[model samples]
Target: MVFSNLPQQQRELPEDGTTNLWGVSRLSEVHRVPVASLRPADSPRHQSEQAEHTHLLANSAQELPPIVVHRQSMQVVDGMHRVRAAELRGQSEIRARFFDGAPEDAFALAVRANTSHGLPLSLSERTAAAVRILTTHPHWSNRAIAAVAGLSAKTVAAQRRKLGPATQTTARIGRDGRVRPANSAEGRRLAGRLILESPGASLRAIAQKAGISPGTVRDVRARLLRGEDIVPLRHRLDENGRGGLNENRQSGERRPPVARLVAAPPPAPGRDEGGVSGIFPSLCRDPSLRLTENGRRLLRMLELHTLDGQGWQSVAQSVPAHRAQIVSELALECARQWQRFASQVRERAVAPVA
Candidate 1:
């Protein structure tokens, strides 16, 4: 299974103020779903790959992975070509995994899945997919969008530019699932003052207050202690993208790698309030959820994967290096499953229990 380009930490995001601990699966295990019952997926590829279909048709059914299906609409999310191949094989029932997510996200998932394995999406197809993502998620950083589209951040930036100023944003969500100001002189300045005001304050505390990373805060403190400028010498391009220093150097969008300096962090994507954990209690209390089997099932599903920040660290510490790869794969699979469930649930809000 493949996770989306966005970090799993922000799973089922841009809408649900929640990070997915886990999600309710419509079908807990792969089963034989009727071929006639499933719908054509909203694929990222321009068209079905005829060669891939032919290849799949030649393979034994046991050799192929189960096709992914949309629980609500019965649409395929990642395996339309497989579906075609199954149909050509004269199979009435095909093995399938269920994905419950919005139509748009389903498309993104399809792109990422296709990119991760199976036949490759052509360069043009990937470019088109990247453009669509930039349009829909204008606030997502180029790297985040590029991960899904399987393109370089540079290419993603170029596509964003072609989208014109209207689609350009002042802030963007980075690859690590952080929302940050495009330019960060203000944050650096603020960090410098915070360090001076409370010399004993922890780096995390200062970083949180200034909306910059702890790494950035540490650097700022180091500079202030030296009685030098808080801004890195390379970033002397300043707030206006020019002028304070280094006129001869490149000041364009792509700059040398340095600890990230963010302007100010924004609220979690599609949210103005608390993040996933913050909303967990309210969801637990909702009658529409607690009072019904469907809702309770979703809740229970979440409980199985519950791991807080410290819990994650403890688990990571305990895992043996020899088994780390298998653990990582399992962890990703869990995330992918929950992400699908969470997206679909959000798309429908609460399906009335009848």
Candidate 2:
């Protein structure tokens, strides 16, 4: 009674059989289908485990009319698990139904029987399902046929693509700075005329003559030269890697990042002197001190005679009585000013807390 991947026809008995439902028979008398090449409940893994408990419904239970079959055998194309479960019960017999047909037809009919309720399939899943049915069984229902054709039953839509004729069009920049396409038949005709007649004319001249932008003229002319047959030059990719006119435009190539084009803010305008005002003359003249605020301030303070206009050396010579003390005090004053300027710049750059 055990079989492997039996089509529906092999699993059925003659329709005119003397066997009666009320007649008792050993469960082993029924045919067993081999589990190979069968997926149970859309899950292959769950079918591998043997269940410990088996339940059976009494024959006396009321039920709807049985599914009738016209042929001798009905294959177990689906529901392998249900069949196994029924066999596990200790009862000698189980309620069953049968269909009669060629093994292949029965297998296909079994699949179409819809014995189990399940979730709706996704688009990609439906496509795959359709492919399988079309490849394996062509005699199934239209539902199966369409599924194999990758049609969405709900939407009645197919993924097969259509390519239309390519056309020429003026490509102008819109007021918003994006590319604009021309549409009028007269306009496209005029553009095509100008292109075929004036071979040496630049895009700007062609656009001017056609009352469109130079960019648009260029686009239309290019498409025409490439021998596209449509009025509004549209580009789609075909299987052979050539341009095609289709409902959807070919995917555009990607561009690089925008951050690379910018230079780094000219190193923050190079604090004129050692600070914002450039009052520190020494720091202002030092090229190496441009990026570093601290270095600039140091150079500026050390050259304090130029910054204040009251020459430090001259002042010390004028009062020779404490020349050494005067130089030391002047140097200290310069250091203090530099610190104050540096702090002011830092404070301005740092944002205030909310």
lDDT against the true structure, each candidate? 0.67, 0.39
**Worst ten in a row by lDDT for model 1:** 15-24
lDDT of 1: 0.67
The candidate maximizing TM-score is 1
What does candidate 2's lDDT look like per residue over 1-354, in tens digits?
A: 122233444333322111221111111233323333223333212223334311221122332122222224333433343444544533333334444444444433333332111112345545544444433442233333342233544322132111112212234222232333333334555676777677778887777667666766676666554434324433333344333344224455432222111111222343434442344433343333432346545554444444223344566567767577867798799789868987987998895977
> What tens-digit string does per-residue lDDT give for candidate 1 at 1-354?
222233544222122211121122323478789999998877888876566555544464344667777788999887776777777778899888787766665666667767766667999999998888777778877877787777998899778767887567767777666787655667888887777578789999999898888999888877654435577664455444442333435544444544322212233444424654445555554434543457667666655444556666998999999999999999999889878977996878877766
Model 1 segments more than 4 A misplaced: 1-31, 225-229, 232-354
Residue 77 C-alpha lDDT in model 1: 82
- Model 2 TM-score is 0.25
RMSD of 2: 25.9
